[model samples]
Target: MNTLMVMGYGNSIAMSQILVVVVEILLLVKIGEPLECKRKEIVTNTPVISSNCYRECEYPSKPTVCEYEFNVVLHQTMSAHCGDCPFKKEDCNLEKCVPVDGSSRPLIAVNGSLPGPSIVVCEGDTIRVKVTNNLQSGAGVTMHWHGIHQTNTNWMDGVPRATQCAVARGSSFVYEFIAEPAGTHWWHSHAGYQRASGAFGPLIVRKSRKTEFNSNTYDFDLPEHTMTLTDWADMTSLDIALKVNIPALNPRSQTVTILMNGKGERIEFFDETGQIFKTPRQMFEVEAGKKYKIRLIGAFIAACMTSFHIEKHSMTIISTEGGEIIPYETDYLTIAQGERYDFVLHANAVPSAYCIYASGYGNSSCPSNATFILKYKSSPLNNPTCASYAVVPASQDRDQYMGNRSKGMFSAIDFVSSDPGDQELYRVDLRHYITLRSYAIYKHPKDPGYLNGFLAVDNVIYTPPLLPFVTNEPDDSDICQSTLNKTFYYTCGMKQCVCTNILKIKLGKVVEIVFLNTDEDIIQHPMHMHGGSFRLLGLGSFHTKKMTLDNVIQLDKEGGLLRNSPVKAALKDTVMVPSNGYAILRMKAENPGYWFFHCHTMNHGERGMVIVLQFGEPSEMPKPPLDFPRCEGWEPK
Candidate 1:
């Protein structure tokens, strides 16, 4: 028999008797167990103060108090390079700067710097930013913290004309508030286009808690860098305005030099001596297996699609203005104006030093500035040749991963001409025409004592008309037309024109908006809506032509276009309208509230290229809340 045997620590049993012997041995071992092996009952301790009954204090002032201090001053100095231009000169052109006080003379900049100090803080921290205006002119200024959910802190919203009065020149205003929501943001002057003249800076909010995916650590371990893109015009802003308003003058064709950070090393026009300005180029050193994070901020007047690449390293887009996305790995990423992106690069085995390149999208005249560099550690492997480095294409279509299909189409208008046989498909509930005008500094009769020109919609200076739809009687039409044209002199104001205020549409009803850019100014204006996005139905030139869906569509010399594009996804916020053209935006007013509609150009918005949306039950109310401050005697007592 195949005998089975059971063996214990020091004893063995044969097959037939193994089962009986094993049971007996186990029983003896169990009975001989020590007392320490016995189970014991556990009792939980209770707290004296009950956690279940705890409640948060309803009072606002009971929390721990915190304070922060900051200061602002103006100094006089000069830099040869203006933005990303390669030309360096020894001229301090103060006239080109926006006056701190609404005056004729320009103020010397703070620290003699364009784009002032960056305000950095962590969430829940109270920040006190002090501004002391030392310009010769007594100007009023205000700062708006963009995208920083002001909520009830409307006092700090910083609309100079809409909120509180501008901080007087030679005076100071203490902006005290708690920073909320950690992310990338900016602050700019709300008192006219002072921001355009170098009154802006980064407003960073650091995370309060320890995050699993720490961007700061990622930034510290690898090469870290930043780039701020801005557009600069050669002429004083005032002159640019005058040219834009006067059709005959047609001054909008001016070339804009895009600045990277504070560097001027891209465009050839500024490099008179042809000597490369190497100071602006950025460089970094990295170990073969290290990682890097690059922060890009588009603060310019135009929208840009950027491409970034290092020879062999793959890029991962970690975050956008909307916060972190499901970290996507890509060769390159596209970013638009008023947007920020954080990308990570794992430089594993790149072999040799690789040049990181950043370029703009479309056929932009603006060239890319080498704002930073990435250096690799020495390795025994053969050095990688420059030819072996993967080059990132500037165009989205050319990118093998991005593909060539257009993201969206363009449309200008959606209306059938009034012909009796035509289907009365839709009635015009709100029919109005708006004409934007820019004027020269000296063109204004009032001489607000500034170089900048005045802006108006429909020949009405500083007055946007109300909507719903009204037509003037023939007899009254002639007189009204005459007053409008002669009142501004900027445009022979034509009467029987549409109003600017109160664009009324049926609740939840689909409506089309026809945007006409009559200003001979050739500068493209990206018209963005705050609450919703629309589809481009059609485009029209001197000869009307049907176009495709495009969120940012350029308008041509003569405005005409059809709306036959398919319905696209509904998005919220911003659309661009090209110069000398028209854009037709279609939207269904679903969420009702007051929304801001304006041009994305920083200067244009300050010059009155903005209006409000009033959505709700219809009313015969004469005017909406023209929330202008009482300073200029425009507000009612």
Candidate 2:
């Protein structure tokens, strides 16, 4: 990347050389989103509106200063419009950053966007992103193109230990891959709590060619209609980890705010002089009666399951994790971390203001602070007359969505016939059953002190890291046989282990995995798998009266006959393993790579719940980037 940039910028070249340089420059500028390590906005001891704010401000950037009331409409007036693009190679520059959070605390940022820059690319375009780690000391940074299913490029999977090592601080590496299976997706840090700092963004893949899912779907498919709903902890993930490093600090229970496209009321700026500074809110405007393709990317860090709804509007589900699904209508939807849903909203209500909301789903009480406004140009901005909607429990909503009858719908099973969107469907070649049992491995086996709650739980536990997990190295061992010999490593870490158990699958084989969550207390584990989109075969309580691995596998073996199993499953890249329950996911192991499968809830992943899916002969896989960064010892020490 440096060579290309230097060569492109050099002078003293002939006319032909100059033309080549100009073409290269345009290509680089077209592909890469140049991110600055520092904010374009100037800073001061006192909170001040950035001088460049008016460049996007609706009122003026000139002598006449407009009051803050004009701020609400600025986002609409200033959003960058991505009109069109020819499918071609592209470049992106992502700088690791430490910026202030909504509450004005130091946080991580990428290219300055609180939630990072939303990447727009057409299906089939190959992209190369140069990521520079500019973060403060202690932590390294690496960005995972979540749900991109990098095909044969496993080295770019972005798991520090599983694929390539973390791109160390001050160093830069180029992440190049093909963007396939067009739909709503995202990118985030694969290391530490850095993701919580603002290192997250949407990865939207447009269809390769216009078809039903594209042209005939809705009236509007503008970039502005999409949003990345993110959760921000009042404290950084690193800070929380530090607190947990002490004897016994309770894990962060939830995020302080749920930001829509990285803006919310909870995110406020204040002057050093103690006066409150107004923060902009994300507002979506619509004509009174038109259908809009509203892509919702669930980019979360702390929260697991989130319930999203737009008051008085019905959202029809179109796709999940980048695969088109039969449109299903619902008032509210519950999604887990690393999940993406592209739905269509019918703005049929009267011209007025309505709130688009999303909140962490756990206890019946909902933290409804993360909200955005939906209004029409004809509606009154002040004293919006829309009434508040009641907060509903996710379990109730989850059951409703799961129990939804697939009769006469374009569900996954119904993909038997030819559909352009149904490009990648794997036959069930080899089925494997796995269960994730989350345990709070405390520093002490038996507690010597008493506390109000389970605050003594140390680091969230995971299986130990498979030492020396080199990116190019492939595990050709028989994983199934090793499991029987008790040679598979799972409990190596007992507490805070990074050991990864690699599940090897033959290329072109269809695989089904059943994940059962056994934590009695923490039931919702947002499981996200890389490299492939799996079908949500089924989700229910344990097959037997008790939750056992044997019973779960036995039940999964009979999935074809189980009454609860869907005849046609829905394709999803992420799903919340129900509390005390299990979910069966099926996908084809056609993409050869070392892909990590883990709980999207970062806490559980940090502990040891992660494992790798190794497919095909590694010799057939692409080599690691020539400039791929390496940790001190990627192989086991």
Candidate 3:
């Protein structure tokens, strides 16, 4: 590993003790394809100590042991720059979107921007933000730092009713935590359907944590080249939530409109007064023959998936869900709702403007498309031979370090010398061979046939709690728990089956989950996990009947299940269970807290298909903030 030097700070301490730092400088002497290796840390800085890490891998075979290091550094408090993390929800007017249809809809904006504001920071920088709910009188709001491993501060997971209650309406909530594993991530309101109202934005963390890092990824990483694609509705999110289950509002037939940066190439932007201004299409400009890093985020609350593609450019996928992945080249990539992807774009093409297109999928209703431009500035109309290096754009600037083609792409990622974890059969601790088919808690029949109102886990339904489990009080009760008497089914408002069902998991146990997408639903399910990421063990073939736990366990015993990848790399939080097939996933319950696992489709999770995985002893977890906001009255609207 390359030696890294930390400087600039006058004090001995770093950011904060709880800060997340990727200490990538570890020397490992490999023997015969990773036969054996040891890791030792030499602390060179004061005001720092180590803690137990949640990233632990206990392999029973050729063990894939990871260096467990939780270095804490003390320093002055940190604050987000006003320019990056802009304001209170009510005070900002971040977005003014007018789609092609010329509709004036209300959206949750930040600093007056539609897609909210981008929180850009470096690897080790801690973040602090104050979010105020300025919506209706009693409307509640809570922000979930999507794809971020909250690490030691699991209470700051921002999951209402689980980690902490929602920040009540007309209230303010402060979120402070460390951000790690630099790449692309986003934040959105976890309260009700608020995210659908535009309560979401990009959060980027860059800079290598290692002293020596790979550069040849891209020539220039223009932070300004950030954009978002989402499914937009003219009606309020609450209204949509109320009517979504109705036959008239059947999602199957209601194609939605797609927008980029909250703006589409619709009727030129005209205000309520019938005035028009330049409705600029989302665009990115780059120097001719230059390589650029572009971050793409999906914040679709209604749509299930969106396929993104550029007219004349191929994207090199370098990172996924805030973690660097095996850099792979592809023409197009499908981004499900709530997922982020970062790719390098090489403007090697002759100087020209190219169309960046995105279309939402999985929904026959509300179909939408967003188009933007990737214009190369100052390209010779005709191919010129003699080129002048003449001080082209900034390069080698640490900020522009998102560079180069990596030769060891396979080393740390897929091209690894060896992976001991793959040698042993899957033995994840949850013990239960869980098999779930995607279904619905219908507004009418047991099987509504189409994705209309509420979606539920075919095996069970989960209801978000009114009170958080992260409080000082012990959680000795949950609706899903079997009572001493007969199995009790609880109901809240109009639903007889809605109740909180928490899936308790032991810490450091290997577990496997097989999701079977039933044919009852016409769409695929993009399942996602919060607080913890899983290894995609395998994707099975389409099955007509839902396999029981016994059957899956039998298949594993018989070596019928597909194992690890042979060529490509795998580490992801979201995986799509085919419309009539299944996806098997494995993971170690390392993090100790209430972790949410659900389908990424916002509407699907809001209604059902949301399950909580409780790791470790609840009492051992960190306590909620002293002034933690209570969401007792903030029930589903």
Candidate 4:
């Protein structure tokens, strides 16, 4: 990586060089340009780490640009059962096979690696990623920077139909943006159900850990401590989504396993002499008595609420959604789709192997669990006796999987933001009440017979428009409603009404959105925003069974709403709205452009649980580049 060098800091430089620097500074000011980090390339094995990359967020004088070239390819798994290979092994040759767990299933890999590759850079550095689509299946793709706030570069938000069109098959798209508000983040496929097939990776914008608010909580923040958790199924994501959409399918969609760091399946290895070698599972080796910062990513495509914990160990969560929070100690974490958390794990337990477990809600079809080994440097290489991938006993099951398990489980309201400036979030200027429900899509618009059921936000199903939201001049027919209200807008109940649902907000308004999940089925929806994160002010269950949108508004006005201190409210880009409950989120409408606000579940989002959160007028937003590609639905005469 390129580092900006200066001859002197105070008086160590020659007079002629100092004069040249002064002249350059004056020239830069005259042109109204700010200094940028020079672009550099580094090759590495792990995602988000390079030996030549900047070590501290405060170093290099000026930011250094990070560049990555990714080729999205369709690949297949290599080994199964006892032949599964461990992650990042030197002898894990991929010349003929790609080992992703023990299942020889098809996957959409990036450069032939599951979980893609990592992108790491210091805050304020420019990130330029050139992605070439080589799926060979004639499928288009788009990559969404999960927690990156695309400030001025709204076109790079990567939401197909909202920010820009999908990079078509065999085509390429270069995404350029400046990384800001550094924290743990991730990236995944934004087109179709490709993320379920492993088109995702870690995206970390580093800041000096020593300068962070809770930096003192952890002793070491190493690059190898990143853990990405994903729900996996035997079938491809497209096929799973198809089964989910069909009501007659016995179990809709199935999540058979959960993968950590792209490694699942507790399989054993053996030598040619028939002697047992070692078990292949994602292992995090640590030293006893040391505190390590572990970045956890919830990259699951399914809607199951997965709980993560290391046996006989506790975690102190320091940050989430790229925003630091006051350290909150918890036994385990219930993570939702598209969420990121950084916690400090103290390795003070006995120097032996322990089970790093992940358990989903214990539903027969959609629920499953997986385990990895957390081994100490002095521990043996064998698997832990306590590391059982089988069903956990009720006494050992910490995730009490009852309906809306909010009584004992830690919720968003439990976290407190460390930033003192977040007090402005509580001063809401506008309030919006959105109710989650399901509507039927009929075979014919006028026919009573329905083909399938689709989820919706605020009673309106989102249909991608023929034109992108940023470039299109949408009229009455394109949008579901011109104006929304504090309560319900238009009710499409069981009728088929799908349109572009865009909610406009005035620039700089502090908005409060109350999301109510009134669906009869017990399910959690992780609601995520594209442009920026928000303050998760409150979360609570409804007290009355007959509560409606108007009732919720009146309850809030009557001081019946659940709210924490505004100065210490939790900041998150995605908040899981509990089943048959509610979540209150507050944020300042600072980012100017069209942004996507949607349910992060893959199938739900694919079937229209999305809306556009438009800030400022269309004329005030940034425009796409002159040569930017444009596309629309196919038209035939």
TM-score for candidate 4, residues paired by index: 0.84
Better of 1 and 3 by lDDT: 3
Q: After superposition, how far is residue 423 of candidate 4 from its true place, in Å?
A: 4.1
lDDT of 2 by residue, 536-569 (tens): 7666654224655555566556853242233346
After the best TM-score superposition of candidate 3, give how far the Cα of residue 411 lies from its true spot, in angstroms.
Answer: 20
* All-Cα superposition RMSD per candidate: 20.3, 12.2, 14.7, 8.6
By lDDT, the best candidate is 4
Q: Give candidate 1 misplaced runs (Cα > 4 Å).
A: 1-108, 208-224, 233-239, 242-256, 266-278, 284-288, 302-314, 349-371, 375-596, 613-637
> What would the per-residue lDDT of candidate 1 be over residues 505-592, giving only the tens digit for each residue?
4456666666665456544455655433444444333212334213223432243344543242112134444445555556665545
Deviating ranges (above 4 Å) for candidate 3:
1-102, 209-214, 248-255, 268-278, 366-368, 379-427, 437-453, 472-476, 481-497, 540-557, 565-569, 625-637
- 1 versus 2: better TM-score goes to: 2
Clashes of 1: 42
Candidate 2 residue 292 C-alpha distance from true site, Å: 1.0
Q: Residue-wise lDDT of candidate 4 within 3-87, one digit each (tens)? A: 6456556655566687899999788768734122222244553233222354667743356666677789888875442133443
Per-model TM-score on C-alpha atoms:
0.53, 0.73, 0.71, 0.84
What is candidate 1's TM-score against the reference?
A: 0.53
What lDDT score belongs to each candidate, Candidate 1 first?
0.45, 0.58, 0.58, 0.75
